[model samples]
Target: MAYDVQSAKTWSPGDNAFYLIVEGTTQEEIKEYWEQLITDGEILQPLAPSQWSPLYGMLKHQFGVVWALSVLNDASPM
Candidate 1:
């Protein structure tokens, strides 16, 4: 996919690196961000329990920005 070429053309690594991997301290926080970004986007991966974290998911924004969201709990270290 040409995500790097599709999202905010003016944006640079200094801005967002084109791909966002948000690690929230709480499930609610990540979920909040997920719900908002996914409004007009696509859910590449549904949110669910993963070996790496309590919750994890992947999605692409309407404009082509890819997002990886998850909860950063004590049990996980990423």
Candidate 2:
């Protein structure tokens, strides 16, 4: 599957923070993307594949933005 940064926005101190959610079909694919993000960015939360679910993780982009990445399998709730 292909992915892209859909859009971006800025905020103030009191305003809500922004989070980009990336969904992928498989854990390997998402993990590869996560590694790329790590090479150029910083890891907020190390990649964790849930025992009860598929996968979930967080990272801070090089552009000073936060992103939540995940891989959803057929058994995933969302």
Candidate 3:
């Protein structure tokens, strides 16, 4: 099977380099997962969260990809 390029966005210094963002159930688990990804060299740099209301983090992956993972509340999807 072959896939066609849908859309490609240019990268800028201000733009995060994340390609994949995986959401976890809890903030703690998300942090742990982020650390694990770093340990495995999946992410290069993890950004500092500017706000506490939303649990967010940024990391540069080994593949030169950047990712942002967020832990949403259980009722968020609903």
Candidate 4:
């Protein structure tokens, strides 16, 4: 999905205004993808356990896109 960062006063380009979530079945799967995205980019939040999932993190890709990666764990509803 996408968003118009200009319309959101709290967000701007290169920020976590829009997140492309990529959920995996295992923490290793998520972590691997997270590592690939962080290259030449920035990490908004380090991968770690969260209330919603076993492993979760947010990061900006090298191409200025944001992403939210997580492991599909029991804690998560979907």
The numbered model that scores best in TM-score is: 4
lDDT, candidate 4, 1-78, per-residue tens: 344443545775455456688889998899899989999999888999888888999888898888888888765666
Inter-residue clash pairs, candidate 3: 17-66, 18-66, 18-67, 19-66, 42-61, 42-62, 43-60, 43-61, 44-60
lDDT of 1 by residue, 1-78 (tens): 123434545666543456678888888898899999999899988999788878899898887778888888787665
Judged by lDDT against the true structure, how good is candidate 3?
Answer: 0.57
Best prediction by lDDT: 4
Separate clash counts for every candidate: 0, 0, 9, 0
Global lDDT of each candidate: 0.79, 0.71, 0.57, 0.81
TM-score of 4: 0.78
| Residue-level lDDT tens digits of model 2 in 1-78 | 223343464454332255677888888888888887766788877788775438888788787667778888787665
The total of clashing pairs for model 1 equals: 0
| Cα displacement (Å) at residue 24, model 4 | 0.6
In terms of lDDT, model 1 sits at 0.79
Tens digit per residue, CA lDDT, model 3, 1-78: 112222575555444433566666777878887877675454433434434324667566565556667776645552
What are the runs in model 2 whose C-alpha is more than 4 Å off?
1-16
Q: What is the lDDT of residue 50 in candidate 2?
A: 70
